[model samples]
Target: MASSRSRRVEYDRFIPFRSAMDMDYARFALTMPSRPQRDGSRESPSSVAYQKLLDECILKNRSRILAFKSAPEAPASMLPQFDEPIRPQKKQQRRIPREPERVLDAHGMLDEDGLNLLDWGSNNVLAIGLDDTVCLWDDANKSSKVLLQAVEDSGPITSISWSPDSTVLAVALGNSVLALVDPATGQDVNVTEEDENQTPVLSLAWRSNSILTVGRSDGTVVDYDFRKDDTSICFYNGHRRGVCSLKWSALSGRYLASGGHDKLVHIWDACMPVSHHHPRRHQWLHRISSHTSIVKALDWCPTRSNLLASGGGRNDHCIKFWNTVNGACLKSIHAGSEVCALLWDKNKSELLTSHGSPKNQLTLWNYPSMTRAAELSGHSSRVHFLAGSPLGGVVASAAADETLRFWNIFETPKTTKPELPFAKFSVIR
Candidate 1:
């Protein structure tokens, strides 16, 4: 009797626990177990066990799906917190205008190579060498006249330079002779005897109104005193090949720069005293070898007394600026194409370069900064020669295409008014 009473207590406790478990299974979408036979008479125990297994499987699958939906780590990168805003970049400002002011039909004016065929005289006259003839164009009066012509046996006129006073012009002929001509009368006032070797006189520069320097093919430079009747006062020998370009700085007065086909640029000091008079030397302050090819393009900065700029030929394709006082290379620019000529604006800190081959175009660069300001295009061939006008802002270019184009690139802006066309310049026939 006591045993039966204990069993009844145990049954009561287990029944309540089983009922709580069934409620939990129902909430989880699981099937509840059916009633089982106490004495194994109504049904087999295996069937009761199978029913219990099915309820557990349903409960486990439901729990797994609930856990998956509440996961915190999945797809974290797709959240709104990962988004960012983008900003735009600013562009560089252009400094120069690209259009040209005038285009002239220089049908017969172009030379075959990189001879300085164009020069602007301080007296407002333009001198151009066309083959065997040297012509003068008066900008003030709009009149053109043939200044002089080469002799039948002489080669074409190679270079021209006007005196500082602008009263006379020094012309270099192909037969290795130099002539002084009067602009007003269009006649040679005096001519030098033929060179002993007959080496072509490719370049000439005036150190002053009375002193002139001529460069020859054998790389010898001779200084002549106009007051002494074409007699050479001194000789400078530093270049290995033809001396093709020469520039004398009026600002510095004593510095003279010469460039040669052997890829050398030398700066000479005319103020240096000679120790003896036997092919005696004028001091060569610097021997610049920065240019790898013929150094045809040379110019001195008008504002900076010691600064000099030079450019190389097709293979070199570089422009270098130098400090003539110390012979230090201050700046270098990789002009993609051949640099044929260089011009510096007197009124602004701007420099212009005329190029050949690939992009036969003109590039305007800001000084010191060396930034490209503008690119002027129109010429179909290499632009070899360049000259800047004394009229403040005008520059002219002569190209291999036999055309002369003028650009007022450095002109300052002004209020609009009824003014004559800037491009209107009379072509003297």
Candidate 2:
């Protein structure tokens, strides 16, 4: 057996440098002393003998790519890579060949006169229009209540949308009145148009907490600020026909997309300057005349801020994806039936489309590839509308059959990190 001192010496070799820590050494010298300065010419004494600067300096005088003529040689790469490597992975199948988890007999849920009244709120509640009444169905409790019932002049509910915060619901009526309903009290703050030949409010979208964009049937889109007394921020008159669909970019809150029955999709920039010196009407960034028929469906990509999807009406059964950054057509698929609505999966790179007439089925497709992953069929008639929850796992479909169905379309992982929905945001100091 070796001596204990020898074993101690051998053990110290395997550890990190311990010259300053080894207490048994006869002389303990400080590697870096910070007492004071040296040379005592009005300066302090040797408080700290600072690290000595290298006397011999060497630098290459020539230029090189990415190196800037550093003296050190290239270091070996530690990246593990291989060619033609194939291995088994945990393949997760899309929730396929399944029926809706729950179904409710939703009477008077048909789409008429270009009105789609289906909106799922962030507070786990589903809202649908029953001809003249706006009903709220709580998804967590499966209980519903008649939130509002239109009477007399306000006959039918044209469109319904929940705000991002889910504190207020915007309900559009047939008689050109936009009612902002507080879900807690079922009270409405009505906004009316006083024009002699009044047009109906076809679509509505919330740009921010205070700003709401109301699209009228006469092709006039107004950005109304409820916080202000004047209310009207600006107006967009690009569409020649009824503006049917409106959606704002979720991340930047800059681009507002609108689709109209004139077969045109207009992308408006909220940052468009409205000068007080020389005021002008808000102009669209891009006027896309791609669809041959009425354009109604509009949705901005949840992951990609500049990407957008628009679907045409019956005469044109095509769903075209657009890159709003440069107004480029990314892809276009000819859906057999009239594409009613388009929704992106919140967790995966998948898209869900509900169709009308002929084959009234819901199809989930793997995006980018555009391959049909699964086809769902439960509705007897044309599936006119689709609304997904905030998380996008479960989707609610309303059809002409006057029925509402909920499908668990997405398979969520056990644990997931919350992704930043807005890709660009300043660091909060």
Every model's TM-score:
0.72, 0.74
Off by over 4 Å in 2: 1-90, 193-195, 274-280, 413-429
RMSD of each candidate relative to the true structure: 15.5, 20.1
Residue 260 in candidate 1, Cα distance off native in Å: 0.6
Assess each prediction's global lDDT (C-alpha) against the native: 0.82, 0.81
Tens digits of lDDT, candidate 1, 1-429? 355544443446645666346665455444424333245556588876775676587544243434556556559777777456666777766345577777766666654444677889999888888878888777678677788878898888888989888889999887888899999887787888886676888788888888888888888888989687537898887888889899998697889999989999999988877667554557577999878898999999989899999999978999999989899999998999989999988867889999998779999998889998888998889898888888767788888787778787765534466867654666634
Cα shift from native, residue 292, model 2 (Å) = 1.1
Model 2, range 1-429, lDDT digits (tens) per residue? 765764444345556566546654323334434322335555444432222222122323332235654544645464455664798898886446479988998887755646769999889888898888999999788799999898776668888888888888998887777888999899976555545576888888888767888888889999888877888878886999898899999978999999988899999887888657536478888999989888877888888899998888888999899999889999999988788888887767888998877778998888898998888998888787889877557889999888999998865535767778564666654
- Top TM-score prediction, candidate number: 2
True-vs-predicted CA distance for residue 184, candidate 2, Å? 1.0
In candidate 2, position 160 carries an lDDT of: 89
Lowest summed-lDDT stretch of 10 residues in model 1? 29-38
